[model samples]
Target: MAAFDALPGAVRDGAVIVHFGSPLIEQRRLAAGEAVVPLTDRTLIEVAGEDRLTWLDSITSQSVARLRAGDSTELLVLDPQGRVEHAAAVFEDGASVWLIADEADAEKLAVWLQRMVFRSRVTVTVRSDAALAGFFAGGAAEARLTPSAPNGTPLIWRDPWHEVQPGGHQYAAVEGHPASDYAWSVAVVDDPAALTAPFAGALAAEALRIAAWRPRWSNEVDERTIPHESDWIRSAVHLSKGCYRGQETVAKVHNLGHPPRRLAALLLDGSDVVMPAQGDIVLAGDAEVGHVTSIAMHYEDGPIALAMLSRRAPVTELIVRTHEGVDIAAAQQVIVPADAGATAGVPRLTRLSRRPVAEDPRNAR
Candidate 1:
């Protein structure tokens, strides 16, 4: 609150101030590489040991065994049934593997990683002293701000969502993915107070993410979320990685089946000037089909949202009902189509015996 109050014209969203007034202008500045955002909502966890990389490799969805120092990647911890439990942006210095995640899940994720350490040489520690900042421009701001990380490498995690990673597949079959323009990166700084420059706020960042159709663990994931449903396979989950907790469901759904739900981008009707809240019901012809997961008013796209709808939901036309019961018409842009899976195309086995035996006639008689 103190940090936000210091800003001249900030507006509060829950505990965090979402913008320093003029969110649309802030977003424009950010896209033009003229701004940076202090990511107060993120926290960092450090995993250190000779066995850190290998130990993490055995657990998470991404293949981390070969992660080189200064390289950036992300990982997802899934339940045995393949539902997303935790997500982190990962990078490593020569000594420690850093996991940056939502502040709400930082301690919980640290505790969980510690519990799984067992006899491994790995030690999990939360680095509460450190803070994270995001810049769509690059690390040029580091030249002016406080030094990042102890090693002087900035400990930056470059986003890989702009393109398909090795051993990964994209479920969104569009000719060009909107995420191609999402050039984003975050730096781990030793001091948050050193970041005194005017920075774009969370709302500005979120609008760009929504416009890109990118999936954020905080917004796009639910208790039952699998990578396929949100089209997260483009970066987070390694398709050919060795056995992990949820590999079975991940493989099964990707190779032979489709996710129960698919993500869609919705362009909302702007006549009401009302934006639907998260969990607002999404309807098709008066029947409820899904609910909005994230909503934002983009600088150029106007009001837009990302929704997870049942595979059977109609693709073209949709409607969202606001908390006031006013129905806002929406047009659906498919992110994950109904027939998104079955990529492996495993050949179906032919019937061994086409002719039926003169079945149990003797027994019937």
Candidate 2:
């Protein structure tokens, strides 16, 4: 609270404050290009030395070997079986690569990166002094408040969720994807004090993200989560990239099979003025099908959530069982369909015809 005490009104959630007193109002202003938010829980990792990009590209999900200075993209470190381990927003300056990740995962990601630096000239260091802030409506203009990179461009990561990147593919089969409207970016600074503008809170930012159908590593991911399940291939995974740790699994699932589960966007019934908490059981009539991964109240959409449901679960109306034993009606918008994969378009063998009548009669005669 001390860090935000200077602000006129605020609300706290756990150790980090979630929003200012007027989150809906702040959300409106943020969408209107009038506000920015200091993402207090985001941290930075710096990778230096000439081998940084090549070394990173050899291990992660994205192809960063040719990532030019001032270019921005995100990468994922998947386990040997292709389960998501770590995700980061990545960019490079002339001398170093900067990774923006959840604060709770920064040190862990840094340690893993350091362990993989065998014989390579790369050096990994977590920059505790730096912080990340986000802006949506005027992200490019707001990014100007931060320090510039060697190329004279603001050190900002333009989010790639709005469109699929070079080696990426979209799993959402919708004609016009809702994520096309997600205009978001983040800027890193040595100190939050450099951002002199009044800011909104994390809640406001989260609401917008949910509405845009964007998935966060912290909220949407679980121990067994794979990129295919979250529709994350739209931004994180590179289908044509060369061998990485989990490349085999990624290739097989995307080309030959469907993910066991899929992500869904939910419109929650807000008649009771109650919201479902994370991990709330999502039910299809009397049977449990999945669990809510994230929920928020949007300025435009009254209440919305993102859930990872079994791919076999019917894509019809559902209900969310709150922690308090209350049932909240939920209408779903399919993000990833049950038949999401099989992108390779392999043909099936035809069955032989069973017309044996003429042949049998001739043989008998």
Candidate 3:
């Protein structure tokens, strides 16, 4: 509780400072250890009513109808033309569901869903005032935790990583009250203020995500972006789920054919590097094949990025050229789609060769 008193108002507004529950400062890579980051841009929406799950499943990429209370799913909602309009972490309680995303998209997504509810007996309310306190731990953790959001999203008390110890690795996203004196988590953490004092601009938090290889919705997804092209097939898609918007295209491209372009991890050359802004051209020798989506100077990996490139681009190291025509070091590594099997030992920075990416037929031309 004492921690909240020391934090700057910025972090207090959108997030709470919690402990790593262990002495993580001793680790060589502090970024890989626990740390606090601001979460001002994100929002939470509440969908309450008898028809919550069934109604949501009709529009989202995942089949929500099967989620038991306390269960959550990563979801994507596509526009009529098949472009992603909203990406969220959805969790269901007994009587409601919560959709968490950036504030700019929460109300719009909820409103869009509400309008589509003719007689489904559903009620969607945008909870723009709600904020999140989250940690992405990567070690061993218990499967069960308390529910914090109105939709009852879990409040994980242990590490989430499977191999890490009880306090090892876990990713927990919980709803918190406003930073006013009534804050909820202050009782548990000491020096909340000091911990949150460092979060200012979104850049610091973005840096953490970049180091974590987390692909953000704003910088990575859009109308022209296909699900597979953003690696949405990995964490966000549920292939076995029944129909939803854009399901046809998703299933066809994933199971029957390779996506025209594949997402890849780009290690930007940072020595004389010009950060490749979104839409900048990526090249292999003289051939223009792909474009950079999101990038940041990594604390450990130098400059790293996510991009979508022509799958036919010779699997080779290349340069990312800015719109201003500056050459930036761009190494390509395929973002294997969900249908691609046996990814156990794939290289993270694979060369873009003509060779089949894997033995899987999904990678076949």
Question: How does each model score on TM-score?
Answer: 0.92, 0.92, 0.69
Please write out the lDDT profile of model 3 over residues 1-365, one tens digit for every residue. 22233444432333433222221221222233333333446666778788888888878877678778766556788765556778877766677777777666777777788888898888888765443444334411111112253334452222111111221111111122111111011001212332431232344344445543445677777557766665555456667677788877776665556566666778777887457788888888998887877776554566777777776777679889887778987766555332332223435675667556686688777
Evaluate all candidate structures by whole-model CA lDDT and list the values in order.
0.85, 0.85, 0.56
Which tens-of-lDDT digit does each residue in 1-365 have in candidate 1? 23334555657777465887789998887777666677767788999999999999999999989888788889999999999999999997778899988878788889889999999999999986666777774434545455476654558888888899887899888887898978888877665665665678899989998998888888888898999998888899999989999999999999999999999999999989677999999999978899999999899989999998999998769999999898999999999999988878577676857534555476554
User: Candidate 3, overall lDDT?
Assistant: 0.56
Checking candidate 1 for backbone clashes, the offending pairs are none
Backbone clash numbers for all candidates listed? 0, 0, 26
In model 2, the number of clashes is 0
lDDT of 2 by residue, 139-179 (tens): 43374466546455568888889998888888888888877
Q: Find the 10 residues in a row with the least total lDDT in model 3.
A: 178-187
Better of 2 and 3 by lDDT: 2
Q: Residue 105 lDDT in model 1?
A: 77
Runs in model 3 with CA error above 4 Å? 1-33, 138-201, 211-213, 337-365
lDDT of 1 at 40: 68
